[model samples]
Target chain A: MSGNENREKYKLNVGKIYEGFVIDHIHAGRGMKLYKDLGLEKLDCSVAIITNASSKKMGKKDIIKVECPIDRFDLETIGFMDHTATVDVIKDGEIINKPKLSLPKTVKNIIKCKNPRCITSIEQGLDHIFVLTDPEKEVYRCKYCETKYGEQ
Target chain B: MRHLLTPLDLSVEELETLMDNAEKIKADPEKYAHVCDGKIIATLFYEPSTRTRLSFEAAMLRLGGKTMGFATADSSSAAKGESVADTIRIISCFADIAAMRHPKEGSATVAAKHSRIPVINAGDGGHQHPTQTLTDMMTIRALKGHFDGMTIGLCGDLKFGRTVHSLIRALLRYKDVRFILISPDELKLPDYMTDEIKRNGAEYEEITKLEDAMPRLDILYMTRVQRERFFNEEDYVRLKDYYILDMPKMELAKEDMIVLHPLPRVNEIAVEVDEDPRAKYFEQVQYGMYIRMALICMLLDISL
Candidate 1:
């Protein structure tokens, strides 16, 4: 087989959006999770997902192209999921704003408290609130139980 | 504005104020007995801890305050799926302050967010037990005469001993407080805790042998190796008797060195050791009540 043919066979069928967002540089294997978490499947907009895309910066990455403008809150939420991700706002097939992702200082109801004895567990209607205690380590702890996120 | 959820919730000055108040309350019990008169303290224990609940109740009673709340989850509305927010909301109407103990790690924090009154966390799973930590501080200050430059040996169950975690965190604010962490490998202090020690620039040594660290310690903080914390019966049986404070171990420690333990001990501290001058665990119980009394007064904003 020709080298060109071999390249074409393995290439992802990711198409660009005329308007909306192109979430780039997602950690490899985490694109699908971000897709579901972002609720792109439920939105009545065109979305393309390219998994295991080769990148010079990141050895392997995933990209999501959406046909609708992403909200600021949604962008920050995406940052929480993968701090390394980059969100590029596109208008008329031209890249506009590319906000750098960072860990939010405080997040509400995003990650559930895992400590079984955490007040969030027994108390109904309580927001599973967490605060970023260690920004360098990207550690979030439950506001109530003080249990570090991912430890539970 | 007062909430005793974690040891950090109280500043060094506030902690000193509490210690001073506790000492004054101890000196003249009758003069301050009625300082909290007509005030109500809600003891919302969502977990069964007889010692902590009683200590809180006794503190309130000694302060001429009335105590009302359930002792267990089954007795409380928690069994009926009532939320901590809801419970605290309802209890705020009846009580001036609330002291809660829950099996869940951050239940009191949830309560504090929703409740209008002050909230004290009696014990919250393996996460925090700040009152016990306060009691420990008061004991250390009384026996050692200061919070500085003490070699505190914490022996047994460092992994699940919430008191050890809280005490260590609280003592870090003091000058030159070092720790001798003595526990078996399986029950060694959690990395998150040790990380805090390293971050605070405090010195600590992790070892398995209690006897080796005894001679160097100024205060021996013994803890019961609780069987309930273990998932496997065989592991519990193996580690339960790892360190027993007896006469020989006491001989190695300084003559003036004190021992502190959150009681209801299950053989980790030998019964014979109670007669020794250094055995301040029983006195710790009294300090727990006194410190709690001072805490209640402080939280309620009563001048005692």
Candidate 2:
């Protein structure tokens, strides 16, 4: 009914962690992907993903709550996925910091280079890295082949 | 520690120095014959480019250095699924420097990252070929005497032509260099390249017809439609003969206009055009050796 009510509803859905991160305002349907990209599943800690959550800023959004330390958390993955997403640092049952996320200058082992002709495609055990070449255009090119991401 | 993965690896001043070194080597090659006497060069060509391979080998041999390596991917450890990183690391142990050509774009960069020695990119798949650009620049400087205020016409296969891309990038550093990009509609320069040209405030005109841009050109660069770059044989066949540089096209060019091609030309330049004094593609090949010789010396820190 109200902004506070919506916030309360989300808080009720996922319990607050003692020490971890709460990635909020993720674009709708990207929470699971962010979870996978961050490799949260591989972690031994409890992780909660909320999809299609109502947002005042964004019409709908996704949120991820990780019940673990922030040391292993990948902020670059979150930044590359959704720069608008707010990362809330939790400590002792309280939000200590709300760090702003922006597109990473370089992302490693996140988005894979799709260019078949790229060395990363054939080489085994190589990190798939992309560099933000054009910040204005938000263009990411494969560090190996220079092939722009999503290019045919 | 210095690797030539692209022409931009060297600054404008460094390029000028390298060019001067190349010119010196060209003038008196015998004087610097023993510059690389104890050096060893590993030519790791993971692609079949006989011209580039020979040019590198010749450059090394002329510098009194020994050359060793496989010519094709099948003949190398790459055929056994060995990564470029591993091959280059191994090559670094045996050779003082390495020149590598691979079918995959940015393969040289990967090799360079793992190499303990200097890595020279001979040619990568439809990507930047710095050595070829060096050769082109050397030829232009020798023939035209300067890079500024030159209207260079680049004809055919601009999209997949690595030399065209590299040459454009290298020439864009100069003042008042206009580019007449002559290529078919489907094979025009890539949008990213055009964007770079515009971003650098370089003047360029894209035209489909070669003759239309010929007469006003100071340098006419012809490129073969690379069959290897094409995914389909039908597309390759259709574009292969799009813009042939012949006597008719040469007739339209300016008298002082020098023609350059990164060779292994396949019907792109007719035999008739080869007789013209303006056709300096063969001289381009010779410059390729000289520039490479200069490049090896620069990379190896060998001063003569």
Candidate 3:
């Protein structure tokens, strides 16, 4: 009964499916909550208890296992989702992987610009491509939008 | 010469050649006028631009070249559903080289692919206007003799400034230059370019107050801020009018500093400063045509 609360035996799989991006995770005391967030697809119960073995190291009698399926995802270059935009990763009626998304170089149009008056978005036939100039700074800007990421 | 596609297509040496010759031509316009005699420059504006299109035409005509092409897209094959590539192909047959203005970002890139003659991108869909970059080079050269070791202040709409973006890209090719970027929080320089600043190891400082940066700048480039861009009008109304440069700001700027705007300015700089010798924007505007003339002549494969 006491082992149910101790956290251990955690692992994350960033299947080669989402190639260009990392479906990352940081585990420790927070490992279980993060694991449950990316829970197994098709599981009916919000809380599923996995079989735990008693471990003296964990100071618990049992360890719960959290499993998730990256079912059928193919690593594509373009990004397709974000937080609060909860969407199920589906392919051929089967559940796949879910990940946060950001656009790569392949986008063909400008959805937004930093300059409201600039002609790119107001006009047609213009595609906005953003190059990741600084990865550490977390900056993304329109090739044409000129509206920089976190520009201030 | 011929068709300015993306700035990435040309080597730094090639851009320098254009700037060098443009300076020589600027010194003696009559010396290079006959080089393109009988050549016809077709504006082919698939959009409305009196400044750039006319400058292209004037550049050709000033160099003893002829001029023709639609000033508006509604009057051209574009209205007939003609593709940009086909129009450029057909135009190349009549003109020795073409200075084109299209509203599409990479439209000139597509035109450059098909045309037999060289293509000059007068302006593209807010993507790039390499000629404006040429004008900036011409301005820098005419003022500073070389692009190196100058401190330039770029203010207003840096976030989406096509001219600012092109000039920054071009300036990165040189050495020992620094930048002071001034604009409102909403109109800050785009991160893509700032990312470039970081990668190139260029020194740059971003600030909200133009007055704060004015004293240290050697060159000042200004762009218009339209009220319509703001998602909220109240913010625009509060900030737009006060952003203009007046007598007070000029005193804070260096005596050697030159003021430049990409034209069609709607009161960004005060009219009082126009009479000052350093108000080089009008001269910059005129120099724009001359550099363009130089560009047209070279791209057309004409010599001397």
Candidate 4:
């Protein structure tokens, strides 16, 4: 395939792999790194963007943008960036989604309240429901486990 | 219906007004259940405080109002780097009144700075917890018959207990009340507080031993020596069990002397003490809910 073909190869449909947080690659022409998770130690790249993912996980629905070397990464690794962005992408013109992700009265994580005595954080077989009490502050609680809300 | 951000907001008359309403609620809770109907009290707990948050929410609910807010940090927009002002500003539009707790000193006051609705400070990071003071006031009035001429003992974590400081400030409003401070030297009352004690002409005495001070005490209020407040875990480990009260300790007091605690106790009092007629902490907690209920009812101007 031609070099232009290589550029469009991983274009937009890049699988949800290859560190979805990868938003840019400013080739510095030196040694770089990859897969900080399993300790890839090092790789070759100019500059890479890592994310402080506020949303907890990465998904295609959250993809702010992705910039890359085109051939070096795979789909799954790229999917992790689904919810984050690189400053370069915005400078290069990528719009951030205005609608913030929220914990709508339902949740997925097991309750982890420090109060072991708290009912919802302990009792089994109950749905963990937490309304978006404050969107600016990401907080949640088990509805059944914490009954103060119900009493209200 | 302004924010109860500090004890200063509760003038002696307003404080008595709240106390009278709370006492009325205690006497007949059902009558006031319909007081705050159709109103909402958004309890924005920026910090996790099961008891304080519950007290306020229970108050609103019992008064026929509703509540909606988070119980922890991860559950708030603070996780998203949202400012306190932004959060309270939004919650105020939804609630007729709100109560909040934050780890930072003056955070509730900061929230009050922007809130259009009445804001209550349930507790703010070792700073102010005025409702607990009101709870203490209502409790003292109910159990001891009057706040005047009473000898009040505040035991444990006195140096760092916001509730203790708030209670002392509130007690000053009463006549001839003498304070007996009991705690480890590492946790002695704050000098600023002692200054207030002196300035108000309220008499006080500091004691390291609870049993030593028990005989003369009219009200013995216990507070936990928080593990986090100690710079040395060894100090807390060495001192917590040392200050605990058992059934034997009650013998040193007047038969009708009341015992109060900010609940969620970690063995500060023996479980067996729960049976004693003098052990009023549970009822105190219940009264707390009613007092908060009455306050919310009056603050929001709802009809019972």
Candidate 5:
């Protein structure tokens, strides 16, 4: 099929949700990981993922449609992961709210502590949390281990 | 108030007060011996440390306080998979204050979260060793009589040396303090440090040759270049003995230049150099104990 036809098919594949959230502007290949991080994969509600969607701003983007609106904590965590990602709460097939996207000062139960000596690495039932040390650089270090989140 | 997690937690006034108390205690040891009459300090050393733990224990004992707790995780419930949060919670019940030395970077913060009593971070891995920074600062303040207008030459492993990082941060608060970063290119100070120095508009130079920087230094802080931190053995061997302070190098330095080392050295400072009057690492050890004693009193809210 032609490129336009493929784009049409891809749009149809991501059917609208009656009530939920649409996480948009996700960097082209990072949608699945963000979906997993938000625990949307384990949800009983219907979920649709549109990968490599054409975008004017991002060149390419991914979108996630969850049949349930995510809570503020999860939304904030998502913003922390990818500041460009926008969350739109949908109800009765209408976009009701677009939550502000900003990096959180501290994130809980998101990035895992990879440092071997970190208490979270050795201890059980402890949530992995990170604190944003350098806001300008958007750098997050583990709250317990202080290990830079992305490097390790 | 209940925990000493980072140097930033203590304001400049509090730090000066701590140093003042430490000096007073040192001058008249008998007067402050029973200051902490019935108190107890728990030393939760998850890693093996001779000086830090002993300094803490000795400090507590000298204040007439009892010392208790494990030296290693293997001997405690930590080996059985106990969390730092849980351990600190349990330790809070047994001791009036606690001093913890952990291999983890922020494990002390984790312990502090659950601890009801005061928690002092003896040392945390490649992160902050606030107490040691306090010791070094106290030592400098004692010898120099002020923190301002000092040129510090930090040699050897700046990359993995937590003490060097902490000392630099602490000293930056003072006026017109310049840093002479002496290290091999492979083990240079991390970008975070240099970035911070630049942000403060402070002066610093990265020089590979220690002897070249020695003559201008008022304080030469030497750190061990550990073999384990390197990716390859060849690079480790090449950089390990990169900056040894021998007699000739010491002679090149100023007559009153203070040579400081966070000890357990592996020939980083030549044995012959220890006999020099400028070598103050031994005095630094005593200051470590006195500072901890002052810190324990300050944390527990006990008067002198």
Candidate 6:
């Protein structure tokens, strides 16, 4: 095969969407988690998650292609899940915009408070909310119990 | 509606106003006797804390308001798995305000979020007890005339004493306030607290022996050091005596110095020292009620 043919064969498996979002450079093996966290599986639109894709910046990366309007995406979920992931908004089969992601100030119903003494533990229908108390350390505390995430 | 989940929930100015009102209520109780007439306060003790529940009830009763609600989880709908949000929402329909003490940290905050009426956090596990901190502040201001320029020596269990941590945070807002933390190495104030003291430009010294800090202190706040907090019996025996405030250690303190404790203290402060005139822990209880009275009036937007 020619070099051009070889490059084409190695290209990403997913096709571009007409007007949707392309989440690129997700840390390898995190694309599925990002998909689940964003609740993309519940959406009616088509979504493709490519794992261990070749990358120059990263040794390997994951990419998510969603075939839906940009407004339909919850970008905050992506920011909370993986701030390093770059989000490209595609329009008419062209990359329209690449939005920067930063840690969200607060997240709702994403992470549960593990502290057994937390009110959320016994409450029947309480949302597990966390607030970013220390942005530098990326520390999140349960909104109800103020228990640091992953603390014993 | 307002809620006192933590001491920091009230700004410095608001605290001043609350203190001023508390003093006024202390001076002439009759003037504010009927300020909260026809009002109701629900004492929602999801955990059993008799002292705090009684304080809230007494505060409301003194203000001509009636009090209601359960004193323990088993007696309340919480035993049947009622959520804090739902309980508080239901309480709001009956009471003008609520005072809640829960075994879980941040439970009061959860109640406050859903309630239509104001919620005062009596205590929440080891998280916060804003009323206790407020009472401490009231006692200091009543005795010392102000919160500024005071050297406070906090002895015993600095690591897990919620009142001590809340008091330190509250006092850090004042000027020229220094902390002399006296605790064993194992129970030393956490690094986050010391860092917070430094970050706020407040001065503090951590020492193992309480006697060394006695002379320079304007106030000595004592908390019980539990036996289980130590890893072994030998360390507990060696360190237990150092934390106890007795007449001998009281001699090293300045004559005008006051001693305070969030009580139910287990022999940490000797009975002999209680007669020292400067032992203000009992008076601290009275101050707790006064502050709660002032707090309820303020939260209900009632004025004399």
Better of 4 and 5 by TM-score: 5
**Candidate 3 lDDT over residue span B1-304, tens digit each:** 4457656556788777877777788789888877788888777888788899888888888888898889888999788877776788799889877777776555676677788888888777666788888887888788878888899999988755678888998888889789999888877876667878878899999998889998999999988875534568887777676478888899998888999999878889899989888888888888888778767766776655
Question: What fraction of the native alpha-carbon contacts across the interface, defined at 8 angstroms, is recovered by model 6?
Answer: 0.88
lDDT of 6 by residue, A7-47 (tens): 98888697668989999999999999999988899999999
Give the best candidate by lDDT.
Answer: 2
lDDT (Cα, tens digit) per residue for candidate 4, span B112-174: 778899998887766668888888888888777788999999998897688998899888888
Query: Lowest summed-lDDT stretch of 10 residues in model 4 chain A?
Result: A25-34
Q: Write the per-residue lDDT of candidate 1 for residues B1-304, one digit (tens) a residue.
A: 6889999899999999999999999999998888888999999997778888999999999999999999999999888888888899999999999999888777777788888999999988888999999999999898889988999999999998999999999999998999999999999998879989999999999999988998898999999987766668999999999899899888898888999999888888889999998899999999999999999999988876
Q: Which clashing pairs does model 5 show?
A: none
- DockQ (Cα-based) per candidate? 0.79, 0.74, 0.09, 0.01, 0.62, 0.64
Task: State the lDDT of candidate 2 residue by residue for B1-304, as single tens digits.
Answer: 7999999999999999999999999999999998999899999988888888899999999999999999899999989999988999899889999999998888888988899999999988888899999999999999999999999999999998999999999999999999999999999998878988999999999999888998899999999998888889999999999988889888988899999999889898999998999999999999999999999999999885
| C-alpha RMSD for every candidate | 2.2, 2.2, 8.4, 15.6, 2.6, 3.5
Residue B93 accuracy (lDDT) in model 6: 95
Model 6 over residues B5-112: C-alpha lDDT tens digits?
Answer: 999999999998999999899999998888888999999997777677999999999999999999888999888878888999999999999999887777888888
Candidate 2 displacement at residue B3 in angstroms: 1.4
- Could you give the fnat of all candidates in order? 1.00, 0.79, 0.04, 0.00, 0.83, 0.88
Instruction: Give the least accurate 10-residue stretch of model 3 chain A, judged by summed lDDT.
Output: A12-21
Q: Looking at candidate 6, what is the lDDT of residue B92?
A: 91
Q: Rate the local accuracy (lDDT) of all candidates.
A: 0.89, 0.91, 0.68, 0.68, 0.87, 0.87
lDDT of 2 by residue, A1-152 (tens): 99988778666476668999999998999899889888998999999888998788899999998999878777788899888889999889898888778899999988899877788888878899999989999999988778888885
Query: Model 3 misses residue B129 by how many Å?
Result: 1.7
Best by DockQ: 1
Candidate 5 per-residue lDDT, tens place, B1-304, comes to: 6688877678888889999999999999999999998999999998888999999999999999999999987998889878888998898889999999887777888788888999998878777888999999999999989988899999999987888888888888888999999998888897767877988788999999988998999999999987645558998888788778899999999999999998878989999999999999999999999999999999988877
Residues A47-89 of candidate 1 have per-residue lDDT tens digits of: 8888999888999999988898545228657888898898889
Using lDDT as the measure, name the better of candidate 2 and candidate 5.
Answer: 2
Residue A73 of model 4: what lDDT? 36
lDDT of candidate 3 over A37-139, digit per residue (tens): 3333435422223223333444322222323333423222223112112224534444455565553433333234555434443434545555554445544
How would you class the docking of model 1? medium
